[model samples]
Target: MRSEPLRFFAWNLGLPLAIALAIFAVFDLTSLDEIISNWLYYPNHEFPFGHNRLFENLTHRWPRIIPDLTGEAAIIGSILSFIWPLMKPGKHDRLLRLLEALRIAPLLRFTARYRRDFLFIVVSFAVITGMIHFFKSHTSIYCPVETTLYGGTMEKKEWFENFSLFHEAGPGRCWPGGHASGGFTMVALYFVARRHQWRHARAILYASTLLGAIYGTTRVLQGWHFMSHTFWAGVIVWISALLTALAFYGWRRLASPAVQAPGSAPPAPEQALSGLG
Candidate 1:
């Protein structure tokens, strides 16, 4: 209700960050990771579920297309916004008459209206995925399957133990789950809806969270990653979305004026976030 930046940071970044820190700290002290990994693994230390056709198609393979299609669609819309007119029949050349032939005036109109939000979704997804990839490459933490617990060579190490000056012989790029992060990027839709003041924005946010959890869970079951890996991936996506939103749309948007309820008295001067200055 008051101080939008504070609220934004608390919900969008702070909470997930705090949970990640907790998982990071606590997971090191417990066998929770191995416990879950062991349950999913077979007696022969094999992870057959990781290679199952059902999981591969439903979880690993199909969900990936969402972000790819979303980014591609956003790019196409942005390009059309620039040339849809010339690309139409009336004022256009032969090759440029794609829009008219396709009869996408409705889509073009929506794109024109929410051009910024759509573009921001692409940017936010790119930034989140990029950051996750960078960290995954750098962290060098072994995934469950890659560990001795699941029949690999690398010894399980603690959080601090993994932070050595040099990585071991087989360094892992599995700490922040890549596929899970991709699933989490659905939150970008919430940002777009929020920018347009859509009433179902919160529903979008909740559903995206659930979708990310499902995505991350599949990876965990498959032994491709630990739970913390997926947990941190979501945190990274959420925080990246917040920063990207602020970067694409200013912090003032985060600090937009509070909505007044019917028959409610006017708010005090301090009710808002001071407009993020």
Candidate 2:
């Protein structure tokens, strides 16, 4: 019973990771990445998304700030929650009072854990951003624009060529599209909301993935990333969110926190484990 979170972690972690790896494998083993990028680029014409005002303003520049700011804001919010327990609306507050009446005490109770929730969010964002950048630093994978397919210097290797971490010195370190990662980082917010069984949780997850896809697609259109790179970024973001949630609350409680024993002093998984030890 106590180990249900471990099971939840395995399923959530395995399923998404397998799907992401499958997506990358499809792109890596086939010419689909080149096929899609080919439609976007020609030796005669440049990758046009770079110059497009709509994409530049909306997707490229503006979105880059969102995850960074969100992480910082959540960190600050969590810290403030320590000083101000009223950061979230109380169960007795106007709108929540109605839920209290309707016996939706779970909502009321979970909302009080805003501090813990915010910690999960910021940590997930950190993991996504940090892991993405770490990969970007170590890998020398070229963007479509840098490859010869689009009138660049480097010979475009077959999509199936060994391209994972070529630590050798080169200008291109564009694996795992960074810009797309910013949008995908919002997935953590969805996980936190879902963990607490909040209303609109599904909407939050859908919106987050859509936003990431939009960001990643814009980069693909611009030749800054292969579809696989963006897919890999999604892998990083989703895994980070899931692992962080599991770390904070464990997989079982994340799946069905309502089943937690009443009067249990430890709300966090590690603390509970520590006491048991």
Candidate 3:
């Protein structure tokens, strides 16, 4: 039997547990006085770049790369968001069926065919969860600095003062916006799944990219993360996806069997080989 303890743990707990534990460990190891001094009084030690300036530039600039569209463009984006999934019906439908089967159908079929894919999905979810937790913890810890630098005072927003809202608001975390990470990861997955030019490929890719960009912008606009944090979050996610893909699929593809030569007969079935000889 395959030992999938890590996969099982990720499936059940997700990445947040790991992140939360790590944060707790950090807090325990470092003194509260030191943490406060490093973050607020002497921000230079915690984050070298001025947080406010970095955010202002990105909030003003990054949107221009894709052009901030008005009425019709916005409607088009909304329409595409709804329509893209319908364009490629196979995988999503299969996933739904698998879920249904888990609830109502037999277990054997699900395990036989969908186990690996399910493991991949679970791992993806775990990674996203971990990214979200990490972002939230880091952002909440640094919000005072960010608010002071950008809003010009410590008493700027109620949201900044309340850490619980980070979980309540959802996706308010400072670093790698979960939406951005998940959206881009979906794009990468789509790129791998459909090597050909499928109907939904272009639409899904464009929509996901847009969603990621919007998420990054929202994080900056909402004062949760600075421009540099958002930018680096994106960098971290891209690197993670690249590394995961290379480790899992890329290596496997390289080791897979080559295609048979044209017009050549396939190898005889093992059951028939002994009789034939």
* lDDT of each residue in 1-277, candidate 2, tens digit only: 7567566766778778788769867887788998888877865487766678987887788877777788888877666544323323544267545555886444324333466777777777778778877777666578888877786888655323434555543455787788888888898887777676777888988888888888999899888888887788888888877878778877655687543355755223222222212
7 in model 2: Cα distance from truth in Å? 6.5
lDDT of 3: 0.43
Alpha-carbon TM-score of each model against the true structure: 0.79, 0.75, 0.39
Per-residue lDDT of 243 in model 2: 76
Cα RMSD (angstroms) for every candidate in the order listed:
7.9, 7.6, 14.5
User: Lowest summed-lDDT stretch of 10 residues in model 1?
Assistant: 268-277
Q: Write the per-residue lDDT of candidate 1 for residues 1-277, one digit (tens) a residue.
A: 5676687777767788888789877775788877877877866567657778986898888888887898888888766544333333444555434544777644654455455666787788789888886676566777787778787888776545554334332357787778888878989887766665667988988888888888888888888888877788888888888889878766655556234365654222232112112
Where is model 2 poorest over a 10-residue stretch in terms of lDDT?
Answer: 268-277
Lowest summed lDDT across 10 adjacent residues in model 3 is found at 268-277
Judge candidate 1 at residue 200 and give its lDDT.
Answer: 90
Clashes of each: 0, 2, 0
Question: Residue-wise lDDT of candidate 3 within 1-277, one digit each (tens)?
Answer: 2445455335323453554455445533344423433444453333333356765466444543432232234334333332222322354667546545676222322222223333443354356456656656644444434545444344323223444634543333444344345444544444334332344656865675565666554554444544333444444554454445444445333223233356544222222222211
The candidate maximizing TM-score is: 1
Global lDDT of each candidate: 0.71, 0.71, 0.43
